[model samples]
Target: MASTKLYCFAQSGNAYKAALMLALTKSDWEPVFVDFFNGETRGDAYRATVNEMGEVPVLVEADEKLSQTGVILPYLAEQTGKFWPADAKARREVMRWIMFDNHKFTSYLATYRFLHAFAKSDPPVVAFLLARVKAAIAIVEKHLGTQPFIAGNEPTIADISMCGYLFYPKEEFGFDIAAENPNIAAWLDRIRALPGWVHPYELMPGHPLK
Candidate 1:
């Protein structure tokens, strides 16, 4: 396997998805810290040299540079041949959950948490985001209630992608899925028991906030 480096900060669950996948796969990898809290991601130098999308968690391996947790997770799954669906239909199932995660689940929850906690935005805006977050979480909670994993019976890249932000502290979003959603909680426990599973804070830098 080629050497892998993930551009990430500890607070970024987006980066955490890629970082966690690398860890779970037991890949030879290292994290290049991105000072996201200081606006490094917004700088022109970083945009031009790194993601160009002003995003952290760019995965650099061999001669390829990949951005977006949705893409990076699948790429790593393919490379490692570890957390992938067994057939075409199953792969489509994985993609469905991954896309749902980006569009509805993690995206809404991340935005809500950022505005409500990190950015400390207005109450009106935070309330609006919170509605979306709750709706998305309900959908995920319902799905997890019936299935052991997001994609199917086994865990896949889809599970990793969707779970990117789910492991973060409940205070960030002001709710605890692990406590309120039994199935989701059980699934999280399973992921936690994986051989190399580690919390996002420990897997990357920039913890405890500055």
Candidate 2:
């Protein structure tokens, strides 16, 4: 068994954030697939034993079980000394972007995609989320035009967090994000070039939703 265990499914970008951190840091981790689409997360057993928050991407190391990518990312970075800034000031900058990502960037995009692709949500609700997603993406798009990464030239947890939802298929979003945003496309390219990078479907189990 690996030293670290990540509870996740392939369709969850939030989960992918932590998985990416573990992979990039070369941590000895294994994925524990959760059948989220099958209502596994809502079960009493799962709520009791795993994460009571009813979320995926729970990181388990020894007796420490961490939930939320915001917490998991920083913990993994601290543990492995990777994907985190060395200076305190730079770390602050990374945290700023990570917070933005959690509140706006990934939140909007993930919700929009889930509704657009899987939930079959009403037009009005989907439109609202889509607009929010576009607005959040535009902020990052412009920001990346000025810097190679979210916090600075180097890739940090902020970059990984911000990129959580962007790698999914364009059809899932009902549009092409990369083709529309050149700077984001370039940034994604750089991230893809990194060692130990893996697509969410290949990295975690439970793809295709069947």
Candidates in order have lDDT scores of: 0.87, 0.91
lDDT per residue for candidate 1 within 100-176, as digits (tens), equals 98898888877888887799979998898888887887888899888888887888988888888889888987878
Screening candidate 1 with a backbone cut-off below 3 angstroms (N, C-alpha, C), the clashing residue pairs are: none
| Clashing residue pairs, backbone N/CA/C < 3 A, model 2 | none
Task: For each candidate, give its TM-score against the true structure.
Answer: 0.96, 0.97
Positional deviation of 32 in candidate 2, in angstroms?
Answer: 0.6
